[model samples]
Target: MGVGRILLNILVVLAAIAGGFYQLKLKPILVKFGQGRVIDPRGNTDCTTVPELKACEKLVLHQPSGVVYLACSTQESRPHWLPNAQRFNATGASRTDYVASYNPQSGKVTKLKTVNFNSPRGLSLHGMDVVASSSNPSELWVYLVNHREPLSGDPKVVGADSSVEVFKTTLGGSTMEYVRTVEDPLLLTPNDLTGTPDGKAFWVTNDYGVKTGLIRDLDLLGRATTSVVYCHETEGCKYAIQNMHGNNGIAQAPNGTFYVVNAIGGQLTVLEKQADNTLIITDVIESDRSMDNASIDSEGDVWVAGFPKALVLVYEHFANPTKVVSPSTAFRFSINTGPNSFYGQKFKVDRVCDRSSYTLSVACHRIT
Candidate 1:
């Protein structure tokens, strides 16, 4: 064959291969990842961005007092040391992160002051839960995920020495008393948690089995190495559910059922607690967009914060949150009691809040 003809044939073969790969592999995956998805702004247009609550990740709403608790940090610090985001520059991480309460009715915001919390590395806050005391009406238990930088190791190499910290505070009060820090080897890469009312035990999500390096990033490609750990003061910690695909935020219903949302795969795994305190998967609900954290309401509905555009969130927003704003949405998953319930619809998923413009930034990292 002539040299020109041979080169042309080679180009044709490469083009055919690329076209097949795009159609078979990349297209389906990107569609599942929420690429080119536009959220409708009809009944879901009631969301307003609170300027005071920037980078507040997880939120727990107190049904009695109508106060919302938030685990917050600055946007600048999040791109530096969020372990889930895989940005591990600990030197730039915020050490003075805080928990704040916002009253929707009164339009008041209070930063709960820490008392007797003397950790040298301070609080690199992430996921959190606010549980009311079983015995006292005025008392509340705050479980916070503190991604504390290791004291004597490179954070990029060793990852955060993550643990769940328990704090005691009064309802609507501005101070939180440091109770104790719960640390276990199983507490690796702790993300979000749901705590017991007695403040003695909790179940936390390990978003990754391995702490640092390439293995941790395997979750991006649909790996199932994350898990949930049941931690108690005396019993230590153990895995409640292992080999979870994308464990992120977890919330417990009043009836003891747990709802866990995934970050990359966007699966909501519903779990039921067993007799031995471990959890078993009861059902799995799928979402069109990737989700970060989840919260249970007073009426037993699960509210999840979802990322509408995965590419913008992963590439643009996290890289420069202040400059670029990614689209966001709020999903409510509840028991299907409508007419569709008879048609084998066990649950109803609704997009309660949708913000597609730059005004509302609701990426996977922060919600509320």
Candidate 2:
């Protein structure tokens, strides 16, 4: 071989050897550190344990240590305390509220990751995304509890309107800013969202006193296509709510059963949407007062977020027809602290994370 040709061949061999070494050794080391080393936020090896947390705040298991423990608690109304977890955003402009976090095992949150918003009143989570449903994916599935219908003699805004705005989310999993709102000229405001596993129609709560909730199916463009009701009077539903109006929290089981929980009367009512176009409330659990948000657990138990009360209640799993109407008392809540017992339960907004005033830059925060 020529001198220059031999030199080129030698250079190629060295490059290949270097590349192989990086692929096998250096690359993995870089990845390990890049993922972040699990530094114990608290230095103590002795983990402070609890008999059983009041409301079961959050169960986070670290990978390195193989240690399983509940996520440390925070002051009320704080978001993003636990990094890398996403939550359902509430309405209005303040920022994020109604936050939830995942188990880190299946990447599904047993607890709501904190999110901020201008309005905290209208926010909840099903603990599910429902990406896939029956034959096809669902278009629009929404639920609103304690929903006050316009027919109850409430004044309607003529120029302005009331509707549920939904959108197809962006690449990063964050929802697109602009949403297509389905204007329910008949109803006032919606509270939550619900649908079956197999793609079908969605349900919306209308008049509280009358006990009629609206059900509608949307198209790909976010247009309301099919709209109707799954009610007791119409179909002679087996399990129904009559006296306690105002439905608030909404959830659904894997078996296509609709679970609607109302705040006014504090009741949880379940119904099955029939092929013959009807709704039957198979079970009813009354007196679930102050219940705000709900999520069906991996074991099919329903978890409700009782705000102000700051309580998390869990209803046991159910099979098919014969049902457990309402979970009288399921789970509870408390403020978790460190080894020193420095932190306690945060009952009020001011005790936890709150906004600052002095500077225009929004730099003030007191984690007391």
Candidate 3:
């Protein structure tokens, strides 16, 4: 070998010897690498099988806390999967409409609180809190469940319908106030929902109980508007929707395309806004059976977390899926949802109408 080559080989050998010594006497250096890991496609997580979850419904990841809070339906209460579980006897909920929170970073739970829900169903995680929809009290009603842990079990009031109560979150604590309810144009006997990541609007859908079709629209300021599509109805444009899972769980793609799940429709549908800015379902993701609520990661790998037989299913692309099954799959759920936090920025800013809320005028001195 040439002198340089000999020197390089000697250096490598020396590094190995030194590394060994350092590992024994000093801090050891560790390196992490990624690989292709195989997972089972058919695993079940349910009260009957996994015995951890009583029933899994809406699931979501709260980025700030690095946790996954799932709304579950149980025969009696939130199951043994969590230690400190909370239960709300939603006077209208079937004893299964309680909320549960878990930390994905540590794979442990921090808090589990229940909202007194009547007909409580769909659940989603927002910022650091939880939003649960229930008609326990009224028709135009939806309740926002906060992250607060109460002192003890709060008995669910019987025959109570407090859906008109609205909620907002602050750094200090959770606040519940009343907001005017808009008429239910969609006739939402709601199934699933997802608010736009931009925090501008939200989408809710009912699983087509009537031929009127599954509900779809934007919730802006408590005002619900059925998407106006036909150009003749608007300015002479015909609108069509495709790529829908038929309203299983409304999930936003990492790049903003929306995917629909049927949960039992046995299909994962995808929807996109047209170039003309009208909405349409364009594609459907399929498997041996219907898929439920799904979450997409930065790599565009879609994770369908759900049940009958519970599974954490993965796909290579939204349109095409290469099945990935996690070993922990084995739960039966009615509905499921989750998110993969890659990296980005999340913030809430104060808005001021005027340019100079506080003026800063600098005094300058002339220097020669």
Best by lDDT: 1
Model 2 per-residue lDDT tens digits across residues 117-181:
22322322111122232443322221212211223231222111233323222111222232223
lDDT tens per residue, model 3, 1-368: 79999999999999999988756533311100002323333322211222343344555554333444455444333221111111233332343244445543344443343234233332222111133333221111122322221224442311111111133222112222333221232322234445432222344444433222113211111122322221211132232332232344555654657655554444456577556544676655444333345554334444553332222221111112122211222112112232321232111111111111111010000111
What candidate 3 gets wrong by more than 4 Å, as runs, is: 1-53, 77-96, 105-166, 170-183, 197-200, 211-246, 274-278, 306-368
TM-score of every model? 0.91, 0.37, 0.42
The per-model lDDT (C-alpha) reads 0.84, 0.32, 0.34
Pick by TM-score: 2 or 3, better one: 3
Q: Report how far residue 208 has shifted in candidate 3, in Å.
A: 1.6
Q: Write the per-residue lDDT of candidate 1 for residues 194-308, one digit (tens) a residue.
A: 8998999999999988988887766776779989999998988999989988898898888879988887877789999998888999999988878888877667778888777
- Stretches off by above 4 angstroms in model 2 are 1-130, 133-160, 169-180, 196-200, 207-244, 307-368
